[model samples]
Target chain A: MSRIAITGIGIITPLGDTLTLNRQALQEGRSGLSSLEIFPTKYASLLPFGEIKITDKELKTRLDVTEPGVTRTTLLALHAFKQAVENCGLSASEIQLSETAFINGTTVGGMCLSDALYQDANFRETGSEYLNSYDLSSVTLYIQQRYGITGICNTFNTACSSSANAIMYGARLIQNGFVKRAIVGGADSLAKFTINGFNSLGILSSAPCRPFDNARSGLNLGEGAAFLVLEKEDNVIDKPVYAYVSGWANSNDAFHPSSLSDDGEGPYLAMQQALQVARISPKEISFINTHGTATENNDEKESIAMQRVFGNVPAFASTKSNIGHTLGAAGAVEAVFCLLNLIHDEVYASLNFDTPIEATGLVPVTEYKHMRVEHVMSNSFGFGGNCSSLIFSKGQKAQ
Target chain B: MFYIHQSSCISHQPTFTGVDLQNLQPSVNNQLPAIEPKYINIPLGQLRRMGRALRMGVGTGITLLEKHKADGILIATSNGGIEDSITFLNQIVDYNEGRLTPTHFVQSTFNAIAGLLGMITHNTGYNATHVHRGLAFENVALDVTMLLRENPGHIYLIGGVDEISVRNYRMEAMAGWYKKEPISNTELYASETEGALPGEGAAMFLVSNNAESATAKLADLKLLHTADENLVANQFAEFVRDREIDLLLSGESGDSRFKRYYTRCEQAVSENTAIARYKHFTGEFQTASALALWFSCWLLQNQTLPEHCIKRSGSKTAFNRIALYNNYQGVQHSFMLVESV
Candidate 1:
């Protein structure tokens, strides 16, 4: 199989708007979990959120978007998409080619404007601009419409693992000869719909989330977007390859809606299958970016899953502690973090970690350090037991 | 060759168990709802929790799984379980985000149907749901074909489902998604209108790479995202230039904005090439093409095209090849080719 190289990356998160900004924050170990800023809600000051500090207006203005029916979700996605395509130097014609596919992942589409939609749907006499943008396809549609993207476009909603699956599907499309290039990623924004939805599930923590910790309370909701420009290894000429997507897999627990199985069967299968695809052993893997959401079930199950895979675990950390679970964007954002690990030859610290879980007795890499990095595993487990893991190897010429 | 071994469809027509869409009476109500079967195997408690979309999707998907085991489950839904989502959102507003119920939120996610299928069938392999409007089913079908190519012997249960959310329907009416003055199914094509009649249904297919006793093979599928007039007029011709098309199942909603694309397809084909329209039998929705694929499979198995489906007479009497062309509001377009085993 020919390698699928990652030629470009674009990310916008609570930590920062640009990839460079986020890299610095990851090095400094700054936590982006603070109270909500742009969204006006009663829980704005009460609970912690990984809300992007920029207002909707600022985002729109920066993106030069003034179109109706465009939501904060679309704006976040467009921002990262533009940066990614630009960084990869894909022309408009190349992007519009039928061989160029656009696969997007988002759980929160236009629902970011749920309040506006509700206000217009019931009270107002006329329809609001947000009526068409409230579904899961709105963000991808907006990007497609704006760019006249005509290729195989798709929007996935596998709960939080949406974007990870998006990336995997893109690579599969390339490997299977469906498309030569794919722009794959996801974007989500802080919305009352999700906030209250998570709150109803009683998974929202008041304090900043501490993933992989013994006393980790719960996950803090976050919002962000990231896009990876993946091209068949043959086409990425003279481009600085951050990393190559070597292997990826998706496995379901089939256990519970919100929780994984007792021994993390989903995670174990996903990680094991991903390793088999990558053709690398556990000892060869330098770091594992765990999906430790700090929720009572996820962190422990994920730790146990790791133990089953690698008996003596390598340096592992969950950056969700730095920036709360970004739902759809977490996978791609953390994929970029993995690329950063490979490109910069370093691993960032997992913040707010005091002690390891008693059951696993495993401690994460607590301090940032330059290290020998070869292959990095990024894991993302979403609601509905959709567990996925992707392995990135140091880039080389296509075989 | 990728083949469909078994299938299930819950449409407005009674094609679930008896499988007789040919006898569907002519009534062109603007909104076409699925004539669902009695969900016998699904537990009543779980059914109570599911909204229309969830029940219909999971019901049909699980049925196919009961008959044959699949390596994966891929679902296509444009607006999945929207009513539940609306209910959850309304509750958040009504109760001021206070003491809210969690079931609605849990069941509202687009992939909830796929998740439920994994739990019930206990077949947890590659699970996915595609939510792109119009392209939902088509894209997922493409995904299934790719998965089959990657792993040669895998069978997948693929489905496309959607339910009418009264709130979303009403809201879409404001944007002219439905006709201002609705008409009956008999008068759908005759009555001049710019909008389509809202419709919803669920369709499931058991597709496998190893085709031994397959009903129909999905030979080729293509999409035309550009509404370029030149491309629309020429794409259908290009797909059928080599293959002898026995039937062309066209999804032409009565909306005239898209009538040109259908006309272009009709003009591209010969008079001997049989053409038929399906939306009149099953109203226009995002995943209606899935229903069309199901209908094509039925026609191949039964060796007959229902009288109501035929739009133009064709030369070939025996239908061995079928083509499906569908466009959603003249924006997203698809051209697919199917062959009988």
Candidate 2:
């Protein structure tokens, strides 16, 4: 079996639209969190968000989507997917081939239009234009149809760890000879549904999130999309490989619906298993991209978990402090950022940090610095105790 | 080969412990009532916060793990936690005044069942949830087959659960997915209805590489999504050409609009081959095929083919090989082959 090589990376995040812009902003310690402007919400002025600074109308015009009922979730997905595929220079025949799989992860999906669907279902005057778009598979179906992909297509909704699982599933497909290439990523758009849902959970912060800070309040909801094109090492021999999807694992806390256990067993197991899969020691992991939802529970539990795995933790940061929690898209978006770290040999700062949690006292990398990063571990923990960790290496390890 | 070690289904039919194929009757009501499993015994505090789908999924998982061991857990759902989602949305619209409850939001994710399974089983090795409409169960099957192929000795728990609510049924009804005139589910296959009777259920299985005391050998699983009926026929031929298919179970949902796809598949098989159908008894949902899989395993284990399921009676001598063809609205087509080990 050939190694899984990530050859293409694309992202439309709160910080920037392209990889270049995002890299520049990250290096400069700039944050994308601010007052929400694109959507109408009661918390617009109270809570800061990592909102993509583009209107859905302009996105549709740019992507040339003439059809209705295409939610912002699908629109953002198309923007990132197009870039990733183009970056790899996949031919039309290659894209139309039956060997290419597309795996998407999303929490918002068409639920962004939940209000419109409600009106349509309640009032009979307006015909339901979004009847087909209400399901989670709507985004995958739209992408499959647009790209004419006939191979395995799936959508995963595991909350925050969704896209991380997608990336792992895509790599598994290629490793098992089920597919030659997989376009794996996730997209989530802010909506009344998520806003109200998170609000009810009492985790939406009024200010920018402080991921590992002692006085951290809560997480700021964000909207964005990221995709990576993974192919077999043999097929991408001449291509510029971004990084290797080295190791991955998923573990559950089984403790609470929304909170991890005090021991951080799930997070610890996921990280340990991922390192085992990569055939490396904890000391080899140069940096850790913590899940760092900035909620009181997540940061402390993750810190304890890291301490258990690595006696002294590596240089770590939570991009969530910069872009807020992207939910389903966080895993893939952070994975892309990890790849950028490997490509540029640098580390980005975790913004809005004053003090570390007293229990763990683990301080994160607070300044951008050029360093040697051979392998990076990204963690994504979601509701219902779904936790996933991924290890991306600077280059392929010997098979 | 993927061997069925244990299986469980919570559906309208009497299939929890073992399938009662003899006393099968067509559902009189359009919405067949879901049977509550008496086997689940979680704590009352945790159980109080659970919904039907979540409870059923976790209960099925616990049952499957009772007599067997699993290294991984995989679950599938077409619409995950729809009841909770609808309730949350309803609260959002109706009571948009105060803070909405977090229970609905917490239970609304598609992987809630898988997460719960992990928690209940505490065997969190590899976990994933596939959420494509009709292909949900099939996707999980593919994953199981692949995993077993990679690591031969390890067992896996695979399940598919989907529940229907009034809101979802109304949405489908508004989309013209139901018959205009009310008709009994028994007349589903023959009636001139435009839609299949909507239904819901949860089914789980413990599959392993070991065949000792196994129910059946999962020979192969295939899925196709194409507009051409000829391509489907060709693929179906390729799947069963070498094997002696003793019985063929077709997803003949009572929708006239897509019944021709089943007919095309039937034409691809031999004339003397025995044919069977099961949608009338199970109702229609995304993971209804999981129930069909359970029924097929029951047949293979007992070495009997129920008469009511037989559409065209060939020489049903001794059940050795069986095949299942499932499709939803002429899309998300799949075939599963099972053989006596």
Candidate 3:
């Protein structure tokens, strides 16, 4: 099997919009959780979210989007997509090649404009502009059309583990010789649909989420987009490499629709299988970017999973404490953060973690420190008992 | 190559419980309802909470899994649980508060089918959901092909499910995706219609690398997107040029706008190749091509094509090889070949 390298990275999170800014914020242990301001909702004052502090119009202006029915989700996706393709400096011809593929992960898609869609369903004499944007693939289709990509395009929706699966699937395509290169990642925008959904589940926190903290009540919902350009080692030898996608595994808990099993069987199997695929022992994993959603079920279950996998957990942290849980984008966003960890040789703090859980007695890395990181494992567990883990190993530097 | 160990479909046709589809009638209503499966010992509480999409998907999924066990599960959905999602969104607007029901929200996700199937089957292996508009089923097929290549000899249960709702149907109707005039299903192809009749259903396949117990062999498949008829013709020629095709199953959804693409396909194949259509029976959705695959397997297994689906009969009586070609609104095109074991 050929090695897959992460040649380009792009992100638009609450911490910062650019890669440099996000890395700097991570180094400084800064939190982006704040009260929702741009969008109005009943929980605006009560809940904190990692909202990307930019207005839709401003984002449109920045991305030069003039389309009529573009959703906020599409804008965020376009922003990150542009940065990723440009980061790799891929030419237009390269992007339009049939050998290339674009695999995007998203939960919201155009459904964020639910109110408009509802009206279009009720009173519209003609078709509403939002009609074409309601499905989950609309964002990806929009990007494909904008870039004139003729290759195979797909959209995945496995909840929080969606993007991680996208990355995994992309690598499989290359490894299997289905495609030469694939641009894979996910994006999600804040909307009333998710807010109401998470609120109904009673998992939305009123303050910044406290991952792995004993007093942690629930998770804070957030929104962002992240994409990584993945290419075969041979295809990207001339370009700069950020990290190598060494291993990935996806497993289901077969337990619950919205919560994980008590023993963390899903997370355990995912991490164990990922390590097995990487051909590395548990102790070889340097750090872990955990899927610490700060929920009553997720944190403790993830802690138990870590213990089951490594016996002694590595220096792991949940960037969710900094950027809240980004839903479908959590995987790719955290993957980028893990790459940052490998690139900078530093471990970012899992903010708001004051105490460890009683059952597992596991505490995350709470302070930023320079560590000789080699292999970092990133976990993304989603609703429907979907759990996925990706192992990104540090690539050899150009001496 | 992938081998189909077991297959199940819950569609408008009488496909459940291994029933014969000879008595199927031409549908008149724009919306064709799928036949609900009879659940035996499964949990009723969980089934009751599921929407039509989840029920159809899990119903067919469990059916296939019970017959042929699988280690991995992959599902494809186009719109996916639109009824539940629209209902949930409506509730949010109606109440406009944080206090709302969680069931609809829980089931509104696109992966609801895959997740529910995982929970029900207790298969903790690879699980994924693909939601690429018209290429949903094609993408799932591609993923399964790659997966079987990597882990040769592993069994995988892959499926495609899409549910239709009034809210979503209305949006599509407003967008003019459906025909304005309701024509008889039998007359769909002859009516010179501009849009297709909306439909939804679920189909599951138990695939494996082992061919010892295979019912039919999946030869190969291709997916493309273009508006050029000549390019489609060339691709179709390349796909069928090497194989001695006995029957050609074309996705002629009765929409004249995309009729040229199918016409190009018809021109690409040999004159003796039998032609058939299924959109009139299964209606049209993103993954309706799955229904085509199921139809192709049925033809190869039974060695005959139902008269209703036959557009042009050929002299070949022995159905050894069947090819499926699907075109979605002239944007997404896919080709799959299935042959008898």
Candidate 4:
């Protein structure tokens, strides 16, 4: 079997725009959560969010996009992808004129644009032309046109687990000799739709969300994009490698449409499958990047799954406390953080920790600490019991 | 070889349980509404949490599992729960971006159906959802076949579902993608139209390693993301000829803009071999080809083709090899070959 290597990474997160800046913010325990102010929503002043502080015009200019009025989701994807393509050190011709596949995962592609158009009273006369491009497929078409990637381009929308599945499929394609390389990940932007949706579930936390904490309330919505350039191991020997996607698996709970199973059976199976594929044991796992959405059900169920698999809990934290939940982009963004952990060899603390949850007795690493991290497992669970786990190793050469 | 064990479809047609191929009653021109059976009666509390798309997806998925009992599930949709998403977005817009409900938001995600199916069946196994325009179902089916080849014991449940909303219709109309003229779906191929009438449905299948009572043993599947007509035609011929296909299921929506691709396929195959079409019954969407697979499974298991599907001046033979060719507009071209065990 061929090995899969991560040769390049690009990120446009609330923590910062560049990967370096995001890593610095994580190390410094700087929280990107603040009162939402970009869009004119009543929830903007009330809900705490992890919003990227940039205007639409600036984002368009930086990403070299001609259509400034396009969805913010597209702009975010372009911003992250540009950095990823550059980081791979591949010439523009290689990316724009090659057979490289772009497999993206996104939950809300152009919902913001649709909302903006639908709200205008003169939408029927003035904004009708733009309504056709508001679906998920159009977003992928836009990106494909911009990059000139005539290869297989598709979008995965399995909620938060969307991007993890994207990465896993990209690796499978490389292993199966389908495509030589792939630009895979996901992107989503803050919209009133998500904010009120989480609020309706009665899970929104007015204060900072505390993951694995007994006093945890709910998750804060955030927006961003993360992309990785993956190639067959032999194709990226001399390139500056970020980390290897050692193993990954996706499983369904089949329990409920929106809620997770009580035993966390699906997540447990997915984690176990990923380990089997990586040919590693639970004891060998150095750290874990948990999908702690700060929701009572998610935190509790995920911790139980962790306990069942690992007996002794590994040091883990939820970056959602700092960057908010980026929905489809969560998996890729968290994977990026895992690679950063390997580079720094330090465990960044989970922000807003107060007390451990009573049911699981799980306490996340609340303070940054220097540690010799080797392998890290990141998990992302979405609405449809779509549970995915990805294992990122320290380096290509292995420890 | 990965073999299809059982397949089912719950569309406007009354073809759910039996293996016999029945001609569907055209519902396109009728003013009388055609409604599906109450999803709640299919099971308990299954429809409570699901929106229309989720209900259709899980309903078909459960029916397949009850027959074949799969170990994992894979689902594909071009636009999942867009109605719910539109409703949620409208609420946000109407309320001046104020407090909005979460049910629609939670339901709007594409994988929600696969996740729900996993939880209901207690089959905590590999799960995934693909949403690639017209090839969504083909990509997911290919993934299932690949997984079955890699891991021998698992019984995989793969499904493709898409829903039609008022907003979806209006949006497609604005883009000049759907036809404005009314025509019976059954007569979709009879005319020289340039565009297809949009429709929605769900199809699910139980695929297993064991070839017991298998409809067909899946031979090979391929998807190419290109628009070059000559390249697509050449690839289709090579793929089918290599697999020794004796029959072909062409995705002809009767749209002249895209019908040429299928016509090219007809010209390539031998005249003695049978040719069939299915999108006229299922409508066009990302995963509509799953319907083509469902029809293929029916023919392979029963050893006969329905009269409604006859497209060419050729007689149906005791064919044991079949190939499915499908595409959306000019992009996302896919080919699959199946043979009797």
Candidate 5:
């Protein structure tokens, strides 16, 4: 049997752009969230967001892309995608191989320019420049056309679980012998479309989110993108691997469109099935990167599910407390965080924590600690009750 | 191998549980709206709030689930809830995000309909939604293949859905997707125009390893991102190398620039193989190929050919082996092979 290994990783989030900056912020327990900047919104001063600092003009100029309707969503995806391929040491010819695939996921595909699109749709003139860019397929098509990637290409949208499913699909492609490697991840940029949508749900927290805490009001919406290059073991050879994708499973709650069941049936089945796929017991998992969106409904349900899976719950923390919930990109971002925990042999603190929820009485790791992590599980639950879980283990363990 | 245990669809043609398609014909109208089912059994409160896409999807799925139970659900849509999305976008602009309501916003999610089906069916496994424009259905089909291959004995409910929104129609027409000049849908091929007529529909299928009651067996499938005629021809030849193809379903829309590709395919294949077209009756959308899939299964199982769909007759009267070739705006190309066992 061959293992699917993560040969490269890249990210652009509220914490930082480079891996070094993100690591430093994690060590110091710093928060990447702040008042909305660079984006125009009525709630700019009234609410906080996980907005990336780079302006749209700077992004376009730096990326050398001057397309008229090119949105921030596409730009952010390109930025992270470039870093991931470059880090994987994939050469030009190798990138064009028939067996190298590209899979991406995003709910906010090109709609980051919602206002512009709305205005463009009302006009009585010729085709608008933003017209072509507005399609959900445009982002992946642009990247494939630019790099000449001829292998299998696809884009998925499963709400918050988009990227996690993207990663799992990539791994499945490799495992099924359809491809030798796959570049997979997702992207989403903060825009009024989602902000207002989430605002209407009344799930936006006024302060930094507090996951696993009793008084946790709601979540803070974030913007970011992340990508990981997964390659078959035989193809990777002696190259450095961040970790091996050990197991994965996906399920739906079938209870509600936005909230999970009271008993967390969906999350329980997903985590339980993932462990079975990994061929490990719940005791083998040393840490967990939870889908703790800090929303009152999610945190509690996730806690109960955790207790059901692990009698003595493993050490777990929600990174959203630091970077906010990145929505479509949350899965891959948190997966990369799990990879970091495996590589650095340490776990970071979950900030803005005070008291545990009365129902589960589970307290997340509120302080940074050095530990020898072996296997870790990352959870990502999304709207429409879409739930998924992935397990990653130290690379050496694969051999 | 995965076989289709059940197949159902709701399209512009009168295709449903027991509707005979002998009366099918191409229309002169540019827009091919789906023929919605009455769904008399659905509760009034729930039926009143559902959108067009939801109606076609859940309506068709419920019809199939009555006879079969699916453990996994997968759906594909190019523009999910476009009506709701347009409403939300306009609301944000009209109200400046201050007086926004959650109705359209909640329903605007691309996977909203798929999630609702999961809730109704009480299916909690492998819920998936693919949204890669014209290739959405093909992607979901490939996913179903992988999942079934990994775990046999489980059945999957898969389908493709898309609905025409007024705003989307006008905006996409401005982008040169639909015909600018009013023309007959039947003349879609004769007109030397640059765009196709807009259409929408929903089609569902149950795939499993069990072939006892199977309609057709999925033999082989492949997806490509190429436009070179020679490469496509070579891949097509290799796809049907050892197999005998009795029929080939072409997904050529009426756009003048893309007519050559279908012509090229016809020229590439052996003359003994019959060729049929579906886009003329179904119009064109991202997931329009779904209607083609349902049609293929129906033809293979019933061994009947509708005069409206047949462009040419082949040497073999029975379609033992069939292939579906489609390209979306010359970007996404797919080849699906089905067999009668």
Candidate 6:
């Protein structure tokens, strides 16, 4: 089996853009939650979210996107991806472009553009030319065109598990000898469609979400993008490796369309497979980045899965409690956080974690702790009982 | 090798339970209503939550799961829940993009159907939903094959789904994806036209490492993304010839440009071999070729072909080797070879 290496990482979350900024926020237990003000919506006053402080114009100017009228999601992707591409310092034109696949995961592709057009008929007529730009394929097309990449391009949309699967697919493609390198990640911008959808489910917390806490309500919606440059160990020899995508697995509860199974079998099996693939025991996993949406059911079910897999719980936390759930971007964003933990040799405490669930006595890490973290497992479960787990191990020469 | 234990599809034709290729009836028009399932027995709450796409995905997924009790589920969709997506988008537009309905947002997701299937089957095993344009089904199928080959004790439920929406269809038509003149789907293969009728459906199969009850053993599957027609034809012919294929199920979507590749495939087959086309019945979409896979499994299990599938009436040879050739708009070419157990 071929080993997959993470050579580059980029993130644009509510916490901040750089890994250092994000780590600082994590250590300080700072919550990015604030009254929704980025986009003007009727629910703005009612729903608080982890809205980013940067403006679209600022992001576009910073990213240097030549195309005008791009969707916010695409802009976010470009901003973060450019940083990752530049951070690697590899000449884009020199790489084997045909062998490098672009795998993007997102829940909404340019729906923000459609939202703009739909709300204003005048804007619709004027922006009619941009309609083609709203198609999901346009995002990949833009990225491929900008980066001059001609290899396989795909957009994965499996809800929140979308990007985790993208990461897993990138690793598998390298292992399967289909591609030698890949740009894999996900992006999603806040839209009325997502905001309203959660509200209808009655899972949207008006206040800041307290994941795994007795007073926890639900998740605060957020938006951002994150990407990772993954390559085979042979392709990036002697390079400063970020982290190793050692093991990953995807599973489905097949329990309910919108909720997880009470038994937590889907998540449990996913974790088991990830650990098995890494050839490591549960005790070897030092920390976990949980898919703690702060929902009553999700917190409870995820706790049960943790207990079943580890017997004794490992130090774990939900960044969602701080930055809120970013939907399709959650997996990649959280993966970046996990990689940051491995690099910084630290564990982030779950913000707002006050009490353990009565059913499963799983207590999340409540404060930042300095630890020699070796292996960190991150979980992302989505609607329809889709569950995915990824294990990011500290960088080490391939065995 | 991964073996296909069972397969089912709910399309416009009466082919869900099983149909004879020779007895297939021609579609009167290009537009055919989907054949609704007998879901009166299904719970009301489940029914209420499901839209057309979700119903199609879960219905086929459940059918395959009930037959094989799979440990993993892998689904592929090109534009998952597009109908719901459009509805949600329109809602966002209607409310001046105000309070977005969470119901529509959740339903609008591309993996809505896969998630629903996972919930219904209680399958907490390996689960993934892939979307790769025309190669969506092929990618999912490849993953299933790989999983079955690597893991000794796993059964995978794999399926492909795509739903067409009015807005999407209109947009595609504007993009020159559809022909100006509407042609019946049943006559799609014989039309010699440049475009195929737009259609949507779902196909699911149970793939297992245990080949004890397999209808057909999947030998190999490959995907290529080259636009050079001649090279694609040569690679495809080499693949089939090397495998000693006895049958070919081509994804001739009634497009004139793509027909030449299928013609080359036919020329490569032996005089005693049989050939068939299935896109006429299933319509053209990213994963429509999955339906053709169901046909191959059916042929292997029943040892017969319906007249509607036959292009050239060759002698009935023993059904041992079969190959599936598929492509989308001259890209994402895929080849799959299967043999009787």
What's the DockQ for every one of the candidates?
0.73, 0.59, 0.80, 0.54, 0.77, 0.39
How far is B246's C-alpha from truth in model 6 (Å)?
3.9
lDDT of 5 by residue, A89-158 (tens): 8887888888999998889888888887787666556766888787667888888877888788888888
The candidate that wins on DockQ is 3
Alpha carbon lDDT of each predicted model: 0.87, 0.85, 0.88, 0.79, 0.86, 0.78
Residue B101 displacement in candidate 3 (angstroms): 1.7
- What value of lDDT does candidate 6 attain over all alpha carbons? 0.78
State the displacement of the C-alpha of residue A66, model 6, in Å, after optimal TM-score superposition. 4.9
What is the TM-score of model 6 when looking only at chain B? 0.93
**Order by DockQ, highest first:** 3, 5, 1, 2, 4, 6
Candidate 6 structure quality by residue, lDDT tens digits, B1-341: 58887787877677666553565545545644446586543457777766676777778777777666777778888778776777776766666655554665676577777676666665667777777767778778767766765677788888888876666666555544665577766667777666777777888888887768778887877776666678777877788765566678888888887888778767777777788777777777877877778778878878776777777756656678888888887756788888899
Q: Rank the candidates by lDDT, best first.
A: 3, 1, 5, 2, 4, 6
Q: Model 6, residue A103: displacement in angstroms?
A: 3.1
Q: What is the per-residue lDDT of model 6 for residues A211-272, given as tens digits with 9 covering 90 to 100?
A: 88877888899988899989898778767888899999988877766778787888898899
The Cα error of candidate 6 at residue A187, in Å, is 1.9
Clashes of each: 4, 1, 0, 11, 2, 21
Task: Candidate 1: give its CA RMSD in angstroms.
Answer: 1.5
Please identify model 4 stretches exceeding 4 Å from their true place.
Answer: A67-69, A91-99, A117-127, A396-399, B17-24, B27-35, B48-50, B97-101, B190-193
Please give me the DockQ of candidate 6 compared with the native complex. 0.39
lDDT tens string, model 5, B131-185? 8887899889888888987888899999999998888787788888888888876
Model 1's TM-score against the true structure: 0.98
On DockQ, the stronger of 3 and 5 is: 3
Error of 3 at B56 (Å): 0.4
Report, to 2 decimal places, the DockQ of model 3. Answer: 0.80
TM-score of each: 0.98, 0.97, 0.98, 0.93, 0.98, 0.88
Kindly indicate the candidate among 4 and 5 with the higher DockQ.
5
List chain B TM-scores, each candidate.
0.97, 0.95, 0.97, 0.92, 0.96, 0.93
Error of 6 at A240 (Å): 1.9
Write candidate 2's Cα lDDT for A1-399 as tens digits: 577899888899998889999999999999999998887777788789899999999999999999877888899999999999998888878977779988899887888886786776566553577877888888888888777777888788788998998998899889988899999999998887888898999988888899899999889999899999999988886678889999998877777778889989989999999998788999999999999999989999999999999999999999998899999899999999999899989999999999989999999999999999999999999886888999999964333
For residues A289-340, what per-residue lDDT tens digits would candidate 3 score against the true structure?
9999999999999998899888988899999999988888889999999999
